[model samples]
Target: MAQKERVGVVVSNKMDKTAVVAVENRSPHPKYGKIVVKTKKYKAHDPENQCQEGDRVRIRETRPLSKTKRWELAEIISTKAI
Candidate 1:
């Protein structure tokens, strides 16, 4: 199996018992080394997942939870925003 990893910000925790995370990715241009931004959203499980907006978090790919949820909360790795 392939291991999955992602770093993101907790955009919302307003669901009944879940959190909506927005993972923004930054990469450098291939030739010029200029930064570029990309983003993706993941709906992860939050069992006692007391996270708030603007909080940095880590998530991992997992089996489907609902119709569109295929990720799970892995860990909260930081106490400050990057």
Candidate 2:
């Protein structure tokens, strides 16, 4: 099976070797037929600890590295501008 991937913005990188990413999912409401945005936070493994808050990154599904870390950072798409 192909591993799942997600593109999201890094929300926090306070933990060592870990980063919290917020991915947004947009879908039409079942009853109202209006677009709704849902955000989910995922803990991704960042071996290099390169991610910082507000950075855009790509994460891929991987074997659990820790209790809540099932995703690994693939690449830094864009960094937060200073």
Candidate 3:
């Protein structure tokens, strides 16, 4: 039983207590070492409605609260800082 963590971009924070985040991962090719980009979208529980779209955030696996929610916002790693 290990916890999973990820860094992603906030896609939407319009929900009352939730936010849609998109995680992007870049991997190097095994042969040519070319970087490949991929993105994944996840629904995370915000509980505070403080996240905003385009903001980078870290999330962790958590107890499911609904059919589509199994992640929670852990922290804001980097932001525009305004």
Candidate 4:
């Protein structure tokens, strides 16, 4: 089966092999019918530590690798030079 994937920005890469990504979603409010922006953060396993803050990335859902890591780095959509 294909795993769930998300496109997001790398908000932090302080861990040795992990990155924190923030994914944004927009939806209409249930009652007000106004657009609402929602952001969620995910811990993704970055085996090579290639991701950095401000980089755009694609992450895929995987078996839990740690307490809060259920996603793995799939690809780097864009890079932020350090």
lDDT of every predicted structure (CA atoms): 0.83, 0.97, 0.91, 0.97
Select the stronger candidate by lDDT from 1 and 2.
2
Model 4 CA deviation exceeding 4 Å by range: none
Write the residue-wise lDDT of candidate 1 on 1-80 in tens digits: 99698889988888866778898889998999999998988888878867777878888888888887777888887755
lDDT of 3 by residue, 1-82 (tens): 9999999999888888999999988999899999999899999999988898888999999998789999999998887567
Candidate 4 matches the true fold with a TM-score of: 0.93
TM values, all candidates: 0.81, 0.97, 0.86, 0.93
Model 4 over residues 1-82: C-alpha lDDT tens digits? 9899999999999999999999999999999999999999999999999888999999999999999999999999999877
| True-structure RMSD, every candidate | 2.6, 0.6, 1.6, 1.3
- The residue-by-residue lDDT of candidate 2 on 1-82, one tens digit each, is 9999999999999999999999999999999999999999999999999999999999999998888899999999999999
Candidate 4 positional error at 34, Å: 1.1
Model 1 accuracy (lDDT, Cα): 0.83
Candidate number with greatest lDDT: 2
**Stretches > 4 Å off in candidate 1:** 30-33, 80-82
Worst 10 residues of 2 by lDDT: 63-72
